[model samples]
Target: MKKTVCAIIIAAFSVCVWLQNAGAEDIKIGSILRLSQGASDGLPARRGVEIAVKEINAKGGIGGRKVEVIFEDSKDTDQAAVAAFQKLVSMDGVKVVIGPMKSSEVLAVAPIAMREKIVVITPNGTSPKISEAGEYVYRGCSRIDKQAEALTQFAKDPMKATGVAILYSNEPYGKGCNDLFTKQFTALGIPVVAVESFMVGDRDFSAQITKLKQSTFDLLFIPGYLQETAPAIAQARKMGIVAESMGVYGDMAPKYIELAGKAAEGHINASEYDEDYATGKNKKFKDAYYSIVKADANEPNNIMFAALTYDAMGLVAEAIAAKGNSPDGIRSYLDSVKDFDGVTGKLSFDANGDVVKQGVYIFKVQDGKYVKVK
Candidate 1:
């Protein structure tokens, strides 16, 4: 009887260990981001995923299976992004991926993602082409056109700019923004007086600024990432161009202020996330974010990129919890559950996998901080 009891106890303990090990099997997700070339944006985005994973794991993970994210550095190139994405799917066996932050990179990897049936959620790829990428691809932020609508409306009513000049980065994102914003501004009865283009790494904007200064425009909109836009604005201002500097969501970082200095003052831009949004969810996210950021001295505490990726990760985790860890399961869950209460706001995905939020928040740089204007 004593031997039989010991045997039974051992058998039960083995079963418990097996069950615990099974529960610990992680549901892996992939993140492909511009970690080296565009680390400013990518780092904040990574932090957002880390925070969401930390929270989800702390709360018993997704359906008792611990969530794990495999990160791959895209280095801000199409080839690098495609390679990273392929590795994530083929080697890491991830059914879902978080990014390839730029539209060009997303466009490059989107075909492969469709072929592999891997669900990809781009947190910041705002190019209008992403709407047609496929059902498997989704975006966390609003479309470029939506941002243009908000920014243009603000230009008409508040800024009262009659003529606008565009200095855009000679790339897909910047060119797309220039085209869309120009159309929106025209619709709002504002004429685009001057247009100039600059390469990605071009630090000297003297030529563009000189030409733009010669033109008569009320507002100068630089449609590019902060890396270029901030410096361009600073150079333009230094060359005595007084057009109120404005930009797209890419300029919504504090780094822009740090780069542009006094030129950033009164600089207007559109943002998908409002840090001051009064909600329990927002407060919780802010607190958790600050706690993590405070610990990591190198982390940029910017809320825009973090908020976008946080919502994306939350959506993925929710889908996994509701359904299994299959791509189709995630896609189906996303389709059915339109309204997700995100830190950004109420997020609803349209048929094209585009998030439908209330509206973009119009912000202006005042005293080296983003102040909400609309």
Candidate 2:
């Protein structure tokens, strides 16, 4: 009889602990950023989420419940990403998770979000395969495949090149971009004249530049992170590969132009957010961003990193408000989100959970600065 009474007491204790945990203080949002180790651009993306969370919490949070944001670094590996994601979802018990920062990380953790019924909103992982990462996986930016189509259109319409050389960073995100570009280039009836590859963080690209210069290609399409891209373009310029160069979001940043100088001049790329292009809806947030970061309001691609993650967090908050405090409820709320205008732009999710993104304006590094090209 004593033992039975003890068992009942332990069960009651466990229930109380669970309830206490659930009713702690505020609604918690999770994020796993590959900030320090992966790509430098990922830092500003994470910062954008931070800035938004602070503002939201300061405004008494969603529905007067304060928001608590949980953060972990992805460390630029599959193992690190998976562990961070598991910690965010299982250990921290988050209702919504923001990111692991890259496509490889998204591929790892998105399955868990689906199984755990948590919404994972990746701000930068743009690989086309995200379309297949179950129902709960959502992203707030353009898909790399769709961007390839837009790029193809840009190549044919605005920046015409008789032939092209393709370069990528040999990651899932980079390879996916390369694949889409290859298909789109073929469909556009243009031959891919050459292809080159380099690992991220390599300082030299002379051999690849030599090959591209010798080839019949009149343009170069590089799909990789900005860290490698800056060096590659600088090296390509030194090696006299004068084709009109372009890259995707992995190469989106003012730092690229700052590093490459004259090499990256006239370079064009597609991005979801351009600070110069935000509607009146983003004025307050934009002002807040400049005040917090002490950055220029006119910087062209500043919106790419911080704004993307900010919108992801904002949408997560909106979903939480729509669903109260349940994971399944939040999932339904996210799916039911029809039109969410964010700091980036309107957030309209297709059935596959990617934002139907197109503020596909091309940008050029004019006067050693990133300037929007209409």
Clashes of each: 0, 0
Model 2 lDDT at residue 295: 64
| lDDT of candidate 2 over 1-374, digit per residue (tens) | 99999999999999998987676468888888876685466667767887788888887888878888888888888788888888887777887888877888899987878777877888978777888998888888887766787788788777776788998888766777788899999888778989989986688888778777768887788888888888898888888777888898766776788788889887878777778655775887777766755664433335577888989888888777777877777778777787687877767788998887555666667788767774
* Clash count (model 1, backbone only): 0
Worst-scoring 10-residue span by lDDT in model 2: 294-303
For 42-138, candidate 1 gives per-residue lDDT tens digits of: 8889888988999899999987778999999999889999999999998989999999899888899999999999999999898889999999999
Screening candidate 1 with a backbone cut-off below 3 angstroms (N, C-alpha, C), the clashing residue pairs are none
Clash pairs detected, candidate 2: none
Candidate 1 segments exceeding 4 Å error: 1-23
The candidate that achieves the highest lDDT relative to the unseen native structure: 1
**Candidate 1 at 102: error in angstroms?**
1.1
Write down the RMSD of all candidates, one decimal each.
Answer: 4.2, 4.7
Tell me the TM-score of each prediction against the true structure. 0.92, 0.88
